[model samples]
Target: MKTEDLITRLAAEAPATAPISGGRVVMAGLLAGLPALALLLGLLGVRPDFMAAMAVPVTTLKMVLPAAIALLAGGAALRLMRPEGRVGLAGPALAGLALVALALVVWRLVALSAPQIPVALMGRTAPQCLFLLLGLATGPFLAVFWGLRAGASTRPALTGGLAGLAAGGAAATLYALHCPEDDPLFFVFWYGGAILLSGLAGMVAGARGLRW
Candidate 1:
């Protein structure tokens, strides 16, 4: 074939955009895995009583690290996944979902009715508020990253929800490993709270990021 014709054929077959880079996939996996790894490290050779009390805070910090990772990873995912442009309605829709999810988490927390209300609200210490704020900051970005991946795969809601559930479950499992308290109250209050927050953030991201 003539050179001109060969060039035309190649152009016609070229993808409209590049595929997700390998580095991004690796980064995402690492970010998602770090918390679990931290939990394992915390558990090794640790006493149960000390582990139980410290586990809550440690797990909370573990969760926070992933959110930071997600923020960077999500931005990269968004850039790669939507080379064409951002799907409309993703930002506003996600914001709305976030509002609803936050409300639900708050309601669940309130129902726990700890003997000392502030302690429950604030977790074991006042510093928990700072951790929660960190979650809030990075959670949305993580959601957006996962949401983009879901959108690329054409299963936005399902992917987003799964991401949320995974995050929740991971945190819960870590807490469970360390927690001495086996009562339903512990799960309902502490474990449940983490899951709910993560899930809500995931839903918001899915709602927003999935839009085309």
Candidate 2:
């Protein structure tokens, strides 16, 4: 057959929609394992003292992990879901801005105050304000992944959100285990904060990235 005819035949045979595979399972497993790993790390005494004046850098590193994980996983998942689609850079950028704005609005509306900024933030000794800022900065990259996952699947937004929540929660739980600060306030503020921020970021990304 001629090359053009062969190409046309191949195109005709391809399914209009890609086959559903085990992508969700992989996402679920990653979501579930993060917390478990953190617990394991904690048991192994991998605590970093963020309270120490000189430990600022170390604490910052710890704070950035969740965002980094989200970005990495989300990016990979997006590519897998739609190999032909381009990355949703704009989605993440918008989501990141929205995340920060929403956080500030909540802070202002509630007039909430922390007991001690560091202890209340991540339960570690690092500067809570600085860590939160860093988390906000990393929101866009992670949001891209969330957006991709939501867009790729036929699943509902709620389902996608739950998956994202699971991923974020699991990661936060693990981070808490390794952290020496056992304050509920810290988890509520920092860990919980991370999940909520990431979720919103995901929503924005999904809305943009999941276009046909």
* Candidate 2 C-alpha error for residue 39, in Å: 15
Which residues of candidate 1, in runs, are more than 4 Å off?
A: 1-27, 35-155
Question: Per-candidate TM vs. native?
Answer: 0.43, 0.42
lDDT of 1 by residue, 12-114 (tens): 9988875555355435644755654464446442335654554465334333433433343233334435444443444454445345445645664677666
lDDT of 2 by residue, 39-116 (tens): 456555445653562255434433454445445444434444544444346346535634653564465335536545
The C-alpha RMSD in Å for every predicted model, in order, reads 10.3, 11.3
TM-score of 2: 0.42
User: Worst ten-residue run, lDDT, model 2?
Assistant: 132-141
